[model samples]
Target: MSRAEQPSRRTVLAAVAATAVAAPAVAGGAAPAVAAPGGSSASGATGESGSRRRRPAGQVDHRAWASFRDWRSGTAQGTRAVPGRRPGIAIAAPAGTLDYTDPHTGTTAPWEYAVWTSPVHRLAVPATEVIASWNAETPAGTWIQVELRGTYSDGTDTPWYVMGRWAAGDQDIRRTSVDGQGDGRSSVWTDTFAIDDAATGLRLVACRLRLTLHRRPGTGATPVVRRLGAMGSDIPDRFTVPASVPRLARELVVPRYSQEIHKGRYPEYDNGGEAWCSPTSSQMIIEYWGGRLTEEQLAWVDPSYDDPQVCHAARYTFDHEYAGCGNWPFNAAYAATFRGLQSVVTRLGSLTDLERLIAAGIPVITSQSFLEEELTGAGYGTSGHLMTVIGFTADGDVIANDPASPGNEAVRRVYRRREWENIWLRTKRYNASGKVVSGTGGVCYLYFPAHPSLRQRLALAAVGVR
Candidate 1:
């Protein structure tokens, strides 16, 4: 019941999502599955069929397994579940070894490996798209690979798809997403698993994640995976989303550092500050939670750089193959590298979701693409960008710590609610040339303390990401 090993351990985990019922980490031996709101059949309206039709509230299903017991519930082969202040899974022994050639470096090396498979997860909401994210520490000699195997509504299983092969450091293996992978039914676009055509009445009904932990042969080193999970949703495809009423209009005071200042500083890391939005947003949240890099950690940066941590973040998060620091999961994983923090990459249904978390004092990082004319008051345009939603204005407008600014003092800006929502939530849009393109579809990254207060847990649960 296994694929032949080429070769690919850890004690890492993520938390429960807003609406994911804490069941056995996988399916079949845990809490009974809870259906998503309205529970539509798997083969219907992923998002395209009823573009204008009002859909049920809360369409996304988020699930993660981070508890020691949760890790023990999964199927393990040469893997061990470690229980402690933070529970996670780690390599027990090498079940096999495989030769991995760094496509970025064209160097081949053999690595010892172990496997841990989550129990089947029956999605309360059958989805057209799924994104998997993990929080782990892959030291100098170790890394991990995450893959998803899905079951369609018709009872067919998908070929296992590689979600990502990653490490905190690039020396071992360049963290990268596999390209040109698909089975004609589903395709992995960057970090996402998307139905090739959701409009065909096809949907992913259930899925399981397989974690492959890798380390240099004969080394005791092992990656510890502290958090791992996926968010699956069938969001409607629309250029515009209905306006949400203003709620909880208070902004959290978050430190801001503009990426613009670092422009051209290190062109190798995604062409420097002009494109360091993702890492900048991540560093803000990491510091907000009291995570700081020791002076020793910042020693490598040039002595003259201001806010050197920003530059450090940019370098650490740069995905060589993607050639950008904007890789969603990579940023989240980078945030988790800080002490006492865990992060996830999931989609939010509405601004209300952001409000709930903000009420509990959690800031959100959102991804969107827009033209200069689309988002009024913003002086620039970007094919894609990352901004931190620290709070809302009294009138419900978004108050974001945008990194694309002239200076840190000007990093925070108020964006029109309607324009912001449409740009971030829509799955389709038109480029400047009037050519149709894809939107971010409400994709966001959530970072919080490893142990949260009850109120924080409730808010995260309500928002469908814990």
Candidate 2:
């Protein structure tokens, strides 16, 4: 469909605000229009470098393009900015192409190509070759990192360096220059690249660019950040998300804790059949494991009490008057609810996040005494029933601890990735915005300690864990 014909899929008022070369980027703000190339952005054209390039006008399959773009745009906004000074970036790809999924809603959507090409902030002749051109500052010194990504006919994706680079004394050119306009020190960088593939005639099909402030972290000191200050051009017509990169995290691990049906042998918090066993089981890992999870991720573990947006809380752990864990210790619901029985585990990108948590050697289990104290103090009941997490196998299998089961209190349950996700996703209850809950007040937050072990950091890198 033409950009104007594109229907609103998932998200609203978010497109072409930020962008890149062959990857993907949306507008930086809610401007009136998304910017596009002043000249034709068709497949066959001259690049910014003025090199004659002939690419398969059909390089990006049209249907696939729609799918990709729709998915990314519909997702919750990541880091974004209001239109101010920087020339808003734009996404360039074979029209109507983007294939990605919304990690939050579990919905599959496509991109709005024409909308992406339309600029929201300042307009660059062609959105692809140039994102935002501005100046920014850093602590070590001012540097730049122009975000760009692309894929070759051989299916090899371009590295971060392909879009731009940085060097010493010269102020990192890789960063988005925001201060070129003197007096006001903003930082922005120009994106420069040539489509060169003589063999297959495959010009750069898709390119996404991001103008980011590159901050060098300091030892025993907080890293400094540069904000986008000013813009050099007028906002464009529209904006969007071009799918030049796959949506795989550096490291993504789903750690399963305890599993129980609401109707199963568990105490119902509100006498509702829905069981809180699995949610309880997962909490152990969140508390124990260490990583940088978004607020949404944390909420998925322990939903809030009043408005369980993403997930539901079985009941208040400390409130004993109602059906609480303090009463049915032997029941499945009781085992999962007891804060004392809580044990944490790691679900990290590389085995490293896990290994680091293990190396910390902090006792993973809360002692039986600790459990009793929590229950009595919080007014939770305690039946004889107990739940345990035997451990996880190297290949990602759950070795669970079910005290109620015969002989095999701990057994390995091999579940397909699809089935596991299905079960977990189905239990999710949502608010209007679809955020996950964490506590009684409905407030949500995530914690990432600065002093993580080196092993944990290294492991996170391996899995592209952010």
Candidate 3:
């Protein structure tokens, strides 16, 4: 479908304006409750410590990019292979061709791709992860592959790195999953490739990305790409906090959804339910604001599934290269593709800052590593996992839509606020067996509707949300 003809899949809900109200601080806390304009105040008492408080909204440092080339302007170099093909950043004749064989199915079909060398993006701020993300749709045998390289301060570029090939149910670039012709169909998918210096042996000081889209020749299925971009962040390995820090709010309420309930329903998408935390969390917030996939949009999914959109989300966000849908920027980028929404990946400094976002009605998807004992009631543990920060409890505990739960009804549960903070904000954690597990300090994905209020804008600005 053409950009103008793409179906609207969800009902539009009015954006909630932030409310400003003074929240009472804990008896000996150092930081006062600073609510965003129009943001709601938390009913719980705030915590205090001599640690540095969160920076004012405007002073926080972060960065995000929505697209690599101007699609509407045709600035990106590529052919308009088919009529009704969206104008910008599409693959066509000359640069892209349709004569390639599907690696998974061996089916030949018409295929095309566009290549762009992005303007040098400077990562002046030290960053640990370079995330390459894009939005696109391809037919049964088509797919997208993204590669990235970094320019260091010395003006040297690293070797091109394959981010991933986003085809149906493909594995990570290293090919860990069993390869196959996945649920032969076409759908928009978003994915991210993380660049860590420790693994790549290159300092990601500055960078650029290369994208290639492919399809089976003569099939007549045209690949549609709407947006492509990259995000870089230097989240610390560990967060430092004083011995005692107070809570930020009494309670805030966000919606809930679980991934465990759908386990084994769609193995093609990362063995089905076990690997869908990212998309499940994304779906909860999307539905919270009245967003949903229409029956037509989800028609590709098997009807036996209960929440087809979750299945759709898993397939749409599946990273052929990574073999998982939990790519950070990809999840945020996927949320951005929906009408009325925008998203970005950044790190929060403290729970105090997180409370500010919750107060402003924005739910946060956070990455953490924890042992079962470290996080009580979670029922399971992981080396790395994602969960939604929907609200805080009366005692400042965390209320979230933990998809790891066995069922949807049990998705919303509270964790000890401080313990949750340690797992969330601090990077170092222990696994269930008390083995030391390093972390990605305070990294989170923030998504919300566009045209935010001033305070909402401030909250977004603090996280470098564009």
Candidate 4:
């Protein structure tokens, strides 16, 4: 969907956590409904399915992906299977669907796909292979740029690999282009590095790497892209994650209605026209899980410390920026800490990183701008303000709790998802410091480049929460 439609998209997400899976749609021709490979019925399998599914070692699974066959079609449709020559094996059709099935759950959900081969022949990669391969032809007359960066044990000075070409013919990926030797820029180095692969027993700098694929602007043929998280040569088991549960919610401040005054009705004012538009939305998610800082009791906004104030200073503090308030720690910190918490706030830098986390079953929290007028209404306030919304109402309305409000009554405001998202456009708020802070003059988002150790801590904390 166009960026214009994110609000409507996120509204569906706000309430997914509480809702159960709807009954599966029976497709056109119902094959004799045999029990899925495992003795359990398809219905039964879904019962066992939580937000995530387990995968076997060494195999690549594509099921559970939120696929968009037609970029224009905002909503993802059911899977289409491409059967393999081998019995009980097939590649999912309808483009982008997975071809594998769960041996435990006989029923195969259309979204769950696996890439498999004839029982006799197979594709395998060593845990240490520095190459990648695909049967699909390279987009002819085009360049597919691959970047390699790994984190050495000390967790500093990560470097980019030397430029390499996807050589003419299809060959098993044997080696990575040599390291592009030079004192690389710190931003590139920090993002590309991985944790030491051999570390075990709670490594603070444990294994983590990011592989980004950019669609070369003038590539003649459509590039067929495949990625599964792995280090050097080992391909880690890839799985699909539903997008609804983990999401970003933006509390839009539109003009006229959501005003930004040099001196607004509230105290602790900035030179301001509203601020905290996106930060408010993000804080709602982070604090939702930690369950601190009730709405009625306003936390003190510390000018010195840019982060939120936890109930117990010992537990957490306003001094440090955290990834988000939600249980999902798909933030720059990867865990909740002063270290990496600052990195998760941007709409741009966090885009790809957030996508990878979401693909791995973590929800990302972000806000959208629907119309331009909403900002005027939400007056800019330096006073601490935040709320949490667990889900939506029966009529696709946003059901949220304003910690600023009273008990049980916390569930008062219900908004049309589109209406809420529409508000983002009017306000200009940037993410900065630990929380969303305002500019001396107008609103804008803030960004910071964090260290790898900070990110590792955040990731661990996020995963640990669930």
The alpha-carbon deviation from the true structure for residue 204 of candidate 1, after best TM-score superposition, in angstroms, is 1.0
Q: Which ten contiguous residues of candidate 2 have the minimum total lDDT? A: 438-447
Candidate 2: regions farther than 4 A off: 1-257, 263-282, 289-451, 462-466
Give the whole-model CA lDDT for all candidates, comma-separated. Answer: 0.78, 0.24, 0.55, 0.24
The TM-score measured for candidate 1 stands at 0.86
Which predicted model would earn the best TM-score?
1
- Deviation from native of the Cα of residue 466 in model 4, angstroms: 7.2
lDDT for each residue of candidate 1 in 222-306, tens digit (9 for 90 to 100): 9899989888889877888888898888989889999988988889897788778899999898878777776667777888989
lDDT value for model 2 = 0.24
Q: In model 4, how large is the Cα lDDT of residue 62?
A: 14
What is the clash count of model 3? 23
- Rank by TM-score, descending? 1, 3, 4, 2
Say which candidate scores most in lDDT.
1
Give the residue spans of candidate 3 off by over 4 A: 1-62, 67-75, 79-101, 108-110, 135-144, 167-202, 212-227, 239-253, 299-305, 432-434
For each candidate in turn, the TM-score is 0.86, 0.22, 0.69, 0.25
Question: lDDT of candidate 3 vs native?
Answer: 0.55
Predicted candidate 4 versus true structure: per-residue lDDT over 314-419, tens digit per residue: 1211101121122111121111222111222222122223323333322333343322233332222222232333444444444443332222223235545444
From the highest lDDT down, the ranking of the candidates is 1, 3, 4, 2
